[model samples]
Target: MATPNKENAPQHGTTGTAPLLLSRVAGNASAPEILIATMHGKEAVLAPALALLGFQVLLPVDYDTDALGTFSGDIRRPGTAFEAALEKARRACDATGVPRAVASEGSYRPSQSLFPGARNVELLAFVDRESGVEFVEYLTDVPTRFVKGRVPADPAAPETRALLAEIGWPAIRAMVVPNDPGEGVVLPEQVFKGIDHEAALAEAFRVCATHSDDGLVHLETDLRAHMNPTRMASVALVGTRLIERLRQEGYASAHPQFA
Candidate 1:
């Protein structure tokens, strides 16, 4: 959790003389409840910033957010990350019965702007349904530690184990899929997601190999925020950026002209 430091305001495009917006939010009753839509556990990642902003966060129950998209490619996300994030915020607000909502969406892929290597683009959206005000912020990190490769067919081979070890293996979650996997084909019998143990990892390679025509398994480090610490950090940083935007917006409301 970042302390409310005035030194951090200037870079966020706020004047030093402006009062702490979080303090004003904390004292105001008209604004408190906020709904955040995310299936995997990230309360700890998001809670700290919301706490500083004096928001009572709400989460949905048994939400089928995978209908939008999935990190494992089982569900193809349509349109841009911004579009998906806005929908998430609106739907979450409706579900939680809150006028204000926050939601985030992220994607991992090779970047043309940063490097040819994998990059993480995380975006957070804040919506005020009553006021029709929306704020969306995003951040991209280069070399996000996102990695993928095919697993060797021979489960007992040293190189197979080495490949797993290189991806942080049991320490981090690994997911397996056929190189040309289709949606709904990512069943536990074939896809072998969330593998975090040596035995499960070996089984995943064997299972996915048999399903693949080339007898190889596509192995990838799971980029889900809850599964990957690197992604979680990116999300947390985005949370800070969103809070800063909200703070700046709050500061502007103090003056009629800016408002």
Candidate 2:
């Protein structure tokens, strides 16, 4: 999805201080607290946007984001990105007992237009329980870097090392899974912290190939915001869009007030 041209809509302005703005503008909307659920390390970028919009942002430590689906393509998530994001938001609402919450989900793969490369779609949803309204913002393109390759038998070979380097090795992690069919045994090794030695890649190769049909192990770019710079940047853009949607006063009239 491409980024939409943001026209200067009056309903989406945040100029005054938090307290002053809330008192004068958002008073009609119930719920003063907001929550953003993510395990993608998006907090660094998203928190500031919500703060500037006059909503207290909360992240419950117990939130299990993987339940929504992982980037490694394991445990296929149910429903579309919007459904998954809404599910995350509702869970946050349940955990914090807050009437307002936010959640985001991203999916990446080959572009429908252009085959066999990379394209990404990000969905950010704002749920106001008081208004029973869900305001969503989405973007495609997003400038992401994702790749897939077959693990080589000589994991320590120069060619294998070059592939890792291209994917931002230590900075971004990779997921190793069987390229065959059966049970998708995925072992996600955090190449970030320790062990740059080929031993790690060698071990990943052995595990995936053993279970695969063609004796091939698959590795792909981990799309987590913390791991992938491209994903983190996209989160920031989506957060800003969500904040703008939440700031709009007329959304209440657009949807029925719940509580």
Candidate 3:
């Protein structure tokens, strides 16, 4: 796939020594700063929870987390979800010289339950450099809007229309790829993501279908935190839980173990 466009990605770094507003949330001027390794607007959902512990959120400018993995299958994720999250947290600290960092990873799969659908599993990891400690929090069977289907190139077809309606297109966003990517790696031209409009979807279907051996396209929900509201909510839920866990462990009191 094409290299991620860093320029178009959201910028998160801030300048100066002035404390961020979140640092004052707990009325602590020296609130610890924690770098968030993300490019999908995750900091917004996680900041409030971290603020409870008098933690200030920091984001690295122009960092591309997609290199680790993507839901679209273009770049296969390495290792387990917890491992990926831990690596990202470490990478953030290494890149920005930040001693503390947090990162998250998400995965989706067919549900093995009685109901026939998919389930989302999200994991968050926090790393403290000084103490050489890493903490992981995760949630399984989280609610998701994930959906996938194989369809012909024709966007005007009834089946295509139905799938679009089911996914709530233009609102939830969608991604398109060749139904059969062949033995070789799928190229950037063969994948279309963040498609929200009918015209774009139609165009993506056409291009992706052209590359498929079966002359079909695979369409599914875009599960990125910024594109998918359902997944974002789940991230927030897990983030809240992580914060509560830290609180229960006496992190706010700076217990000797964590201190």
Candidate 4:
């Protein structure tokens, strides 16, 4: 059981696994492996950073991470992002037969004291079982790419095209879902590249609207690392922090508490 003072020891809906691991840094090649558990598709940005620190970075294949939660707002995650991140890290360690892991989780919303769309926060974590150390990091910004708008089902709506340009296109991808949140239908793949033709986008919107509860489609940026460059940048920043924590001198020394 995790202690109450622990940052991630609340009611996270996950099975049994140690909350953290610790590593004693040696020379370069023999450094312990660190698994980065994520469904946000972070391998490209994060793996390099771990490699730079001489720790092998691993990602699990068989686990269904969506069981934890998803970005489409369908599943209500039980714990805070920190708890969820530790759960994910523990899952990776269990699956790979390794003792150390790393994971990250992100949340986005408008500024509480501001207008409808204002700012966002991203949280990242690194969990080590050998030393029982879990390090947390965060970043905040008001220039997020999150936005949503309702468009008619019509294939040739002029307003839809205008909205597309308003949001950075051909670069930052958009999420397509039913305007009604209750319908539980989100088409993440329907995210169209702004570089694609207007006809393609119109068709995409039409398909989403046809199945929507209110015959309206909601469009917003995908926000996943591979989809949104802004998110990728954030992942890179998080990766740098994780690497630094792993390289700490205190982690290099032996500790009786771990034994």
Candidate 5:
């Protein structure tokens, strides 16, 4: 991925000073903590926003978020994005014995508008077990580098190279699997993810083609938060929205009394 332009990054809050929202919640002797359920370093993108509200972001160890769902279709997501996110948040609390947690879920689909690419829908769920309150924030039609199609197992071919360029290969990662698999069961060996270099991409196409019935590989951009910069940006955007919603609901003002 291209280096993120730090100078142009969005500012979540003032540096070194507590925000007004933080002051409202400062009655508590200890800062409130919210666990972020993720294995893809989502806390880095989300933590700053919640920190603005005086929330100390926590990450659970050995959290397996992929059990909830995976972008590569190996494991199907169980429900709507909101449900998935809520479950992840709830599970995080249960695992870490924390009363509050947050989780993010993203869905991508072909754009139905004038645009020809994909659209990403990002959702963030915050659950406060202490208050028995759960809320979700989402942003739809977010931009993404997601692309998918079948191609022959030849990385040097013009069509293959064109497809790679379209997905911004070497910067954005790729995932490959056989275009057609019997019984819709894809084995671990047949699936190659996080392919960034040309050599790895070539090898993935070769391996997937061997498994494909028609000798075609199904290639797509890796949508993991750590793999896709665009998706990370979307997560940050939605996280900011979540913090805004919390402020609007006066969660800090209301919950500080209990703290």
Candidate 6:
């Protein structure tokens, strides 16, 4: 997904007292090609920022990144998020035949703070094989609207409907799965996703209950970046952070110490 054009140059907006990182444009002379390793349309958010620094952003396809892991629990993500981001970037570079690439990864977990039930930790990475430079930046959003809970078999019940309303269902897009596995269900058919309508909700609940030993359905917000607007915004913010760093520095940029 090509990022929508904003302006030729990125705006210098800083949230804190820190100076805007728009001191100098990067890769302008060489105009390096940047391949964004993302399957969830993240380029739509990142390209404009990289464009400001005169980097051409490209999106590559036919990558089995899910073999690495997924936001959903269906496949477990490997190593730390920083590791995952760099690995994804390397894979994207290999696939596109581009030495410079960008990648993003997001981690969702219950908030340890007092604000909300959950937090979104978004990470972005840039890899330049020519310079042997691999850098990453990360940000955490405590105001994230992540929540999950279990619903009874009958979603048509009044209390269940109220729960749906509280979770902002039919808009946020929910996923339903069995509360527990039955004796013979190697792979339960209760995993229904992208569910937003009341009709689909009822059906998912019925199937999950009928197939599960616990007779209950587990419902959750779909945390995929493309599926969740809040998460996608975080991805964009992190991309901007990467752009800021690139503008302010050269080959070496600030990143968490990795071993």
Name the best candidate (by lDDT): 5
Residue 223 error, candidate 1, Å: 1.3
TM-score of each: 0.76, 0.73, 0.81, 0.71, 0.81, 0.74
lDDT of 6 by residue, 121-176 (tens): 77898898777888999887723356676667787767677666766676667777
Q: Candidate 1 lDDT, tens digit per residue, 2-34? A: 233233221211223432122111222343666
Q: Indicate the worst ten consecutive residues by lDDT in candidate 3.
A: 18-27
Cα lDDT of model 1 overall?
0.65
Evaluated against the true structure, the overall lDDT of model 3 is 0.72
Q: Which pairs clash (backbone N, Cα, C closer than 3 Å) in model 6?
A: none
Better of 1 and 4 by lDDT: 1
When summed lDDT is taken over every stretch of 10 residues in candidate 4, the lowest stretch is 1-10
Query: Which pairs clash (backbone N, Cα, C closer than 3 Å) in model 5?
Result: 1-171
Candidate 2 vs 6: which has more TM-score: 6
lDDT of 3 by residue, 16-110 (tens): 54321211111133466677778887877886667557665556655678889777767777776777899998877766666778899887754
RMSD of each: 10.1, 10.4, 6.6, 9.2, 9.1, 10.4
Error of 1 at 27 (Å): 12
Q: How big is the positional error of residue 99 in model 5, measured in Å on the Cα after superposition? A: 0.8
Give lDDT per model, in order.
Answer: 0.65, 0.61, 0.72, 0.59, 0.73, 0.64
lDDT of 4 by residue, 124-161 (tens): 77777776777777666724466667777664577665
